[model samples]
Target chain A: MTPVGAVATIGRLCRITRVTWLSELLEPGRMVSTAIQVGSQVFLTACLWTALYAHTEVSAGLQEHQAVGYAVLAVLASRLRPLSRDMAPDSFYRHMREGTILYWFLRPLPPHRYHLVRALGDQAHGLLWVLAGYGLCTTAGVVPLPDGRWTLPAFLVSMFLGQVIVYQLSLILDLLCFWTVANSNALHVSHFVQSLLSGAFAPLWFFPGWFTTANSFLPFQSTLHIPLSIYVGRIPVNRVPREVAVQAVWCLLLWLITRTLWKRAESRVAVQGG
Target chain B: MAGGTALRRSVYRLRLSWKLTSLNVRARLEYRVEFALGILAGILWQASVMVFATVLISRFPGLGGWSSGGVLLIASIRLLSHAVYGVLFANVNRLHAIVQEGKLEAFLLRPLPVYRQVVLHQFHINTFGDLAVAVTLFSLALRRLALEWTPFKIVFLCAAVVGGALIEAAVQTALSCAALRSPTATADWTGWLDHTLSTFGNYPLAILPGAVSGLLTFVLPVAFIAYLPAAVLTGTYEGTLVPREIALASPCAGVVLFLAARRLWNWNMRRYEGIGG
Candidate 1:
């Protein structure tokens, strides 16, 4: 494909994806349900953090406000990242049974790129939720601003890289469907491991030293933990560049891995009986 | 004659369900590696929250003046409830797909009752993993809390486990029944409700703001499933927003909710015409 043609395809895909997401958001019942769901989660996390801070002698090296900020921001940020449902065993089984996946091969553009665009669109609603949560938390005085000057800019950049890394990781899992006929259990197991290792459930700092030390060797910590830690000023401003660099490195590594896997996965698509 | 026939039918269905469940487990075991991975994954998944609870309790003594053991008891009970719910009620999750694809015809064509067919469609083999962990943790918490054990407390403990499971199954059944009326409405909301109950149910209900605590207790009744029951056993019943007598009546509440859910399910089910049927 020519450069201009590729650009046009991307633009069209983005528009289609965005329109679908917009319609989904506009659905009144779904909108209300999401608000209630997200509101409860934020409120629950705030309650949990408040209790933790209240009884502890040491505030886990964070001020009460900083800890609250991290708790709420982490929950809000979790919304923006979604892994592919293709790896889920049930979906793969249906696609295979119905031969729906053949449609992907017939598409003009690669299916992976199409999926990436859709993933971005999926996050559109989550982005709105995050904005609303930030407003609510701020107005309610439930969370405080970060201590450092560079926190906001650094957090934004790092978070983008974090999402990319998460997307690449999920794509790699999805590509595993080429090997295994049933991967539903694998998806469930992987999701649980990734969410915990990513520190979405709790800050990695609270974990024992050996766990955090082992986590440093892996890429999961760089996804949600590093970005949120930066946002909450847990990582010093001087160390901001280092943390962001770590995320970028993980993103690039996962990107390369996903690309290689996609090639292999395409070749291995065993077409069964007519 | 009518009551005897009903009893006989129930016995037959229970025996058939046991056989079918065994066969399902055997089929899953054929893929040994995958089966093992699923169980391991489930254990790890359930363990995550326990680990989180550990970290929190380590930092703070306890929420609502309950000890670490008290908190762990609550967590363990919740897991046990979830395990039972998975075994007995998780088929409701599949109701969305069954209705969406008009697969209800399969159940309708079966010789068995539609509810029985749907409920026993697939036994959740993964929940055994959760059950094992919950039992182990509950034992540990029991040892740690060191409550004076009477025959009554032991019996209440048994009742709480069964009651907690009933409450969860009731909620899930009601949601599934509601899904029959509006396909898109209940599935997402059911998931949200489950997540809210399990996650928020971990902490002491006393820590939640008054309105939220009341909502959990009186409206959703998630409090009865784990928190209030645990509070009663731990002698910390005073901390709960609701009365101690209400906490003690959790078993009765569970029975009442279960019957209500059944009535709702039967009423809605009678009116259900398959989406694309």
Candidate 2:
């Protein structure tokens, strides 16, 4: 895309994000203050992380870089709220099954595009909170801009992909409510599993030999660990393409899974109604 | 004669509570797959502690002159305390929601003390997984250390674990009383405080700065639950005055905190406006 197009895209994204976020802002000052508090809490967590690194005799480099990486990962991990049973997509799917989707179905825009727009809007709201957290960490010196030239670009790409992957996974999990009334347990279990596999609690390197090897081939690493590693420049510049490719593959796979699930879900709804 | 009758009534109530708890476990078991999955999830949660230990140990052979075995002792104590929190006092964490939904008034109308009823209301059987993991880790650390086991040391460890549970329960109860004060604040603050304390409390107090360490030890008394007791058991501090003080005072801290918490809970009861009242 051209620079102008890229700017335009970002502007559109920002507009979507701001509008969604503003919906919750009945009192803008209170919302901003709450956001700041959230940011400060993230800063305190980063401080604790730094202290742990300094005290523990971990390798100096890992202690410094990976500690910050894990700190950011921890902040992000805490933001995931499991979809409660009441909040599950059953009602939405039921509407779709009952042909109420025809309301939107009759609209000029495709249903898939509508869903994408809605999700993007939601994600933009979430991204604002994340930025608040990032700002807090930066202010506290818990996160420093990379002295190395490659750090900025690498971190931006990795974080973007991480967000995409996480959103996709959540969407996939939410889709389960289309078939099952009791998807709460599945939601909780999937989140717990994701946290474990994604190296939110610890680096993937610390995982047991077989699990670590397996995780390397999976998209779970790309969610937090791979991006973090790239942010810290643990993986060299030459290896950037392979890392991005791995993340891209996971994204593609998730997209395919989501497409198949949506189609099957629609068919199930049709059959049940008939 | 009155005291004797009261004692008998207490015993009977305890028995009834135990039966009720067992029934809950059986009810949970009806969903056999979910029960199994919950147990597995609990184990995985426990295993994350070890994974963290592995990472720390791999990076630093020792933390502050204490070896990995010493750290394991602390971690095990923490796990046991957490198990108690999960199994017995887990409902304390839910008190905020109950208060908001006006459910507490139902219990208040009953003859039983609200606190006792609350404690006995729910049981998370998955806590057994944490208990098992903690015991296994403690034993492994003991073997690795090659410390000659004495009856005195075993007694001390048991006292420490019991005391730790009491302290954890007390803190949770104290936080629960916030539900009576500001319903929404209870959820926001208590959850944040619980997570913050539990995660940060796992590491040795020495890892933190002096002020923070003082805050954990005195302000929150989290150090009493895991660090101080583990320090005594592991003999990590040979000649420190702080260690001596902690060894003597940590268990007593639990008793004091529980008494204070009990008082606070009763005070809050009077202020409670039942649902729709």
Candidate 3:
């Protein structure tokens, strides 16, 4: 493509992102809500970890600071694709229900690219919240800085890969709506599962050996746990490469699967009112 | 005659609620597989609490001097009451959408109380899963406790569960008043409160620092939902900020709070211009 064409495409994608952001912009209250929720969550999470560590110096190979740091960071990282962002029934299923999904096929941009660009926008918006919270918490001394010189760089790389895996997994969930029209329950269940398995609710560390071992086989932990563990230095700087590699492999597999599903989903689409 | 009229009124409400609930459940049943998965989701929803409670007990042994069994009892009480709240009153959480869609205007014209009509708008299909897990945990908690099973204790336990549900209802009801004015903003606050409750509500607040604990007690009153009652049962209510007498009357707090909140809701409704205007 010509430079002019490429620039125009980039500009259009930026505008396409409004599907992910226009509502929040239209209602500034949502922004205030995000601030309050993020702040309180970090505080509450930090307190819980510190309280738990009060009795014992180390449980599951993590000290007060390490565990506290991990828990606090998990709360902030969760801001990346906060659960509440999707609570409003808008997106694929709503579009399908309202019989407007065909617009995806008719648009100049491919449906899959449109879907992904929206997620990209959502994550970008979420990243702003994450950065602000991270800065505030680190300054406030609620959360500590990375101890190792390479820890911050390694964590950022791993976190980027992990988020790619998250976007693909979300795409798969979105595609399932083509098959199951009333899949709200499935959506809720999937969110809870992701939160539980990804170590957002609690570090996979505190869980029993069997639970963590089982979680290793799933892609969910690649989304939040690995990056967070790397951040807190629990997974060790040496193992960061291997962990990021594993996350990369999951991303590749999910990408292929979601790509194929998007093709099949087009044919399976059904409108709500015949 | 007044007493008879009151009894008749109660019966009428109950009968209408049952009819509406059946119709709602039937609608849910149209998607059989999704309905089944929804129940699983409900159980999973509550299971997150259980998982945290289990991890805490197994790893740490005791929190705030409360034993595993005592903590489990507190959790079970909160979960069961939560099931009751989920079934009967959680619909208020969706009030923002209702008001935005102009459904509230239609509800205001109905003969029944608007709150009741709004609540019974649809059955909470997930409560089936919630109740199953809650009952199972309560039973397990019972087995763990070595306390004497006196009739008074059993009755108080039941009352505490009801009180816990009422307190939850009261909180959601108060939040719904804001939904009338700013549907979008209130939605976020409502979601935040639910998260805070689910995340922090199950534990013994005594374990937290004095300031945070006091916030939960005085500002939020989440402790009265189950922690204090469970603490009182386990004999750990002594260190709490409230007097022993007030702690013992935790159930009464739910009653009084619910009544006051209901009155507030009525006043808020009268002032409600709604989003449509």
Candidate 4:
């Protein structure tokens, strides 16, 4: 596609993204439910971390504020993924089952680009939640601000790269539906693995040395841990570039693989609903 | 004579359900890979919980003053009962999808009870995996705890597991009442309830603020599932928001609360307007 055509496609996708917002705004009940869930989640997390720190001043090289901030940030960062999209009609498995997938192949837009567009839209919505939660936490003094001048900017850049890696990972996950059935349980198991390994559940610093070492070799830690650690000053500003570079490498590698899978998936497909 | 006939009829129904469940498992077995992965998923979920808890225990001196063994006991009991709930009543989570797919209409036409059909809808191959990890952890907890075990305590332990499962079933069943009409919204609440249970159910509620602890205990009855009962077993009632006598009777309270929730479900179920499209 030409650069101008690419811009036009992105613009149309952005409009569709607006419709997603409209759809969510249309459901006040779900919105309220989400607010309550996120509120209670942050509250409970802060309480747990506070309780855990009551005895020791520091454990695993993290102070009370840093640990609490990291845990609370993890809670907010977790909201970065749209919760119900997997069950929505746009999902690959759902589309395949409902026979609407043929439209993707028929449309002028390519399926791979469509997938990325929808994922970007979802991340936009999820980022709104994260922003709201972060604002609440910061204002309430539940999470502390980082000390360095460059911390916020560096964290933002690193977080962007991390989310790219995360999206690439999930793109591969959705593409798995081309060969397999629903497998919701397997999906859930993978989610658990990501949460545990990605430091969404707890900071990797709390984990033993060997576990963190093993995690460093995988793409998971860069997703949540590295960025949050930077925000909380666990990973010093001097080391920020190194961590972000690792994340960018993971992103490039995953992007290449998913692109290959998309090619294979399109070529392998035949009429199914007939 | 009437009671005997009723008993015989119930027995027959139970036997038929067993046959149906086995057939369901057989059908799932047709997808060999999904079946194996389903079981693996269950084991990994349970194992992940243990891993998180064990790592915390190793790092922290004690969680909110409860011994590591005490916390483990609560976690094991909660997971064991959760496995039981998965076996018997986890279909509540899927009720929305079932309604959306028009399965409920078919269920209503069947001779068997709609609830039973829904409960038996899936094989729940993962429950076997959850049960295995739960039992192993419970055994390890029992060995590590400093408390002495009596015959009464042992019996109460068994009752506690069943009661805990009942409480969770009741909560989800009551939530499912709304699923008949507005399934999309109901799914969020059930999902949140599951999230709450998985995150908070393992730890002692005392770690939380007093009001939050009360919310889990009285408003939601999550504490009744395992923490209160486990507290009674070990006599570690220090931070429990409720009285000693109340905690001791948690299992019994679970029974009462579940019965009340059932009554609520039936009342709401009557108003169910299916959205079978």
True contacts kept of each: 0.59, 0.18, 0.57, 0.49
lDDT of 4 by residue, A106-144 (tens): 887788887777777778988999998998899999899
Docking class of 3: medium
Q: Tell me the docking grade of candidate 2.
A: acceptable
Highest DockQ model number: 3
lDDT of 3: 0.84
lDDT of 1 at A192: 77
Clashes of each: 1, 0, 0, 0
Error of 2 at A223 (Å): 0.5
Which residue pairs show collisions in model 3?
none
For candidate 2, what's the TM-score of chain A, rounded to 2 decimals?
0.75
Task: Give lDDT: candidate 3, residue B223.
Answer: 90
Q: Residue A273 of candidate 3: its Cα lDDT?
A: 56
Question: What does the lDDT read for residue B145 in candidate 4?
Answer: 89
Q: How do all models score by TM-score?
A: 0.93, 0.82, 0.95, 0.96
Cα-based lDDT at residue A212, candidate 2: 76
TM-score of candidate 4 chain B vs. the reference: 0.96
Which residue ranges in model 3 land beyond 4 Å of their true spot?
A82-89, B274-277
lDDT of 1 by residue, B165-194 (tens): 889888888888867766555556777877
Question: In angstroms, how far off is A18's CA in candidate 1?
Answer: 2.5
In order, the Cα lDDT scores of the candidates are 0.78, 0.68, 0.84, 0.84
Q: How many backbone clashes does candidate 2 have?
A: 0
lDDT of 3 by residue, A8-79 (tens): 999999997866678677778888888988887787788777777777998888888888888888888877
